[model samples]
Target: MIDSQLSRAEDPELAVQVQRLHQLKVCTRWLGVIISWLVVIPFVTWQLQEEIALMRDHFTLAAVRYALIFNPISAIAISWCLGLTTAVLLWQSGNILFGFSSRYRHQLEKQVRRIRRRGKSHVFWRWVIGSKNQ
Candidate 1:
């Protein structure tokens, strides 16, 4: 079914439709990510407030200080990790959802390999001298 859809995209009208569908899917995926964060942020904040009140009532001053300070620091560190992970996952999902063909991937890999083979000096000199193709 997917292969037939891909082949049908060779037609201009079908290609346009395929592109629109891909865009809609990408948009919906991001909307899902946004909606999830919206629901999670408030729930997490509520839980944190309840936990903090418990900490203040029960723990020692030193313990409370540690919790107060470290809690946010740790939350920030964890949030950063989660955000990075989400970003990478979302990007990959977008690529997959938008039909980044394996042929393009292989071509990109070949280009990268060729550049790596040229070495740093060759690339640098090419840029410095404004040369196109060695």
Candidate 2:
């Protein structure tokens, strides 16, 4: 679909802008999937409970006490750690991987604004809803 659009574009600058927008959209989508997995994997796993049981069985009182004290703190710590990791990775990818400097970001924003005013609702809603259906 984007290929057709790019092929049909009369302006070279517009073609490049569209290509960049498509690349950024793809990056946003994959980043969302990666971050969701990072945020969800730890809490969703059964391994933690098994490990807690192992500690209780092996180390008895000391492990149980430490585990009880540490569980909540660890959950909070893990959440913050994952969040910061996500932010850092996103920044790194934007800067290094995607070459998305602030200037290109502003250009993308302006292009999106232009699209919005042109009655193209898909541009605004695509990232929010993760849908291509218009």
Candidate 3:
């Protein structure tokens, strides 16, 4: 589908713009993941401080094992969820900062329609995309 779109785009500048938009999307996603992980790590550590202190004081194999297993697992799960919010914010900000071309706008509207079809049952759908009336 994208290949067809690219083939149909005769203007070199339009192609370049589309490519840059794609790159921006990819970069924002990765940046969101990094930001989420950075935020979550310190937060999770703070929340688990008591457990960490107990492990430090006792120095048991079980405590060490639990710390190794649980902290990262919980942090990752939390950060993975948070990353979506950050990514959406970042992407929206990018769109605002760099206004979309007509071609991009059409593409974005199509994507928005697809997202709207997912309905309010999706956690982020209503907040991010809004209702059909809006």
Q: Which predicted model would earn the best TM-score?
A: 3
Reference-based lDDT, each prediction: 0.55, 0.58, 0.63
- The number of the candidate with the highest lDDT is 3
Query: For model 1, how does the per-residue alpha-carbon lDDT over 104-127 read when each residue is reduced to its tens digit?
Result: 434433444454466555543333
RMSD of each: 14.4, 10.9, 10.1
Q: What TM-score quantifies how close candidate 1 is to the native fold?
A: 0.41
Report backbone clashes per prediction.
0, 0, 0
TM-score-best of 1 and 2? 1
Any runs in candidate 3 off by more than 4 Å, and if so which? 1-9, 54-61, 64-134
Q: What is the TM-score of each candidate against the true structure?
A: 0.41, 0.34, 0.42
TM-score, model 2 to reference: 0.34
Worst 10 residues of 2 by lDDT: 124-133
User: Which residue pairs in candidate 1 have backbone atoms (N, alpha carbon, C) closer than 3 angstroms, thus clashing?
Assistant: none
Better of 1 and 3 by TM-score: 3
Where does candidate 1 stray beyond 4 Å?
A: 1-10, 50-99, 102-134
